[model samples]
Target: MQTSDFLAELSQLTMGFTPVVDPIYGAEVYRFLDLSTSNTIIDSVDTSSAEAIAVYIDTYLSKTGGKVAYGGYLEKRSIYDRSLYFGTQEIQLKRNIHLGIDIWCPSGTAVLAPVKGRVHSFKDNKNHGDYGPCIVLEHTIKGDSFYTLYGHLSRASISELEIGQEFNAGETIAYLGEPEENGDYAPHLHFQIIKDLQQNEGDYPGVSSLGNLSFYKENCPDPDILLKIESKVKG
Candidate 1:
């Protein structure tokens, strides 16, 4: 079966599941970030200060009565330009389009597994504007295998975690890291689903140029298919 077909079946199988169990079910609120819109806060973002980004997200959440800010798949963000990994002189086309759903919340928030999976790999990507501590899980549903990546997690999350360790759905796997450790950005979880790793270990490209959108889109499907948080975003 194709990746899309596999994901569609998985979505149906997990329609009512909750990806995040922290802050209690139905107790917390969520806000959606529309980076594609020029009139929105995306255009006014400083992108330099983690404090500024946190404050912007917190302010938006407060105004919208949300506890978390989420969204980003396929959305091109100038924020990625802050990292040389995306804007190096050697590369002609810059990678600004996000390939995952980032859930912005307070540091130390519990990051949970949405499905049963085994640890495929883990790493501490210490580069500025990088994923920081990351963990990739390999999962098989309906006899089809795929991988899920959790990024921007605290060191403690994987301090004792070993390769091939298994975790169940809703199991606490990691916690959000502070700005100093989470790639110098606000505390958030960069969650992505990949049909293929391209031999990449704990790290994978979370952003790509517009010219490569088609390829990345096919490889990294919308994570909301698993999280099911899109409908809960505050309008």
Candidate 2:
């Protein structure tokens, strides 16, 4: 399907806050975070250290009385500079544009599906700054087929899984992995919507360089359109 058509279909998936992570932290308390290089606060600490970034997020969450810190779709992040897996420091070639919505939470936290889907593939991408223990689910709704990727998952998340397993909306599909196991970048879930896998199995590019930004932005639309976690729930 065309990106426009798929995005249009996604727009009609649902409205209101759809929890993609554990609901223990109600939708109301979820905070949108800024991790891009422009965030001057990032310069205050070490971005290369997973513990440092985790602490930074923890502080932000505590200060805002938020349970979860989310956001990052199409966000240009400088943290990727810490690893060569992304590419050289060259601007045009560097894959610094993040294509997924990262949910900052404690490790081992339950990760849920915002929509019902079946397992497409799963793998443990062990690169230095890559998604570790990832799972991709193929979902078909309204005759439009797409995918949702859950990355940075615990090993157990994919250890006993079958290729064609099915999961329902809001079902616990995986658990967050620790920094050591999750490409050493703090504990969080990298959730993305993929229109086309291009034969990719468990792994997909979560970041993109400026030169290829346009194409990736289309292939990977804003996940918030489906989750709607950015909006506050009305009391």
- Find the candidate with the highest lDDT and give its number: 2
Question: Pairs clashing in candidate 2?
Answer: none
Which lDDT values do the candidates have, in the order given? 0.83, 0.90
Tens digit per residue, CA lDDT, model 2, 68-185: 8898998888899899899877889889999999999999999998888999999999999899999999999677678999999999999999998999988999999999999998
Give lDDT: candidate 1, residue 136. Answer: 97
The residue-by-residue lDDT of candidate 1 on 1-235, one tens digit each, is 7766786776874655365536463524767766553536666878878898888888888888878788898886778777786775334367888999988888999988888899999999999899999999999877777899999999898899999999988899899999998899999999999988888898999988777888999999999888878654421
TM-score of 1: 0.92
Model 1 error, position 94 (Å): 0.9
**Which window of 10 residues has the lowest lDDT sum in candidate 1?**
19-28
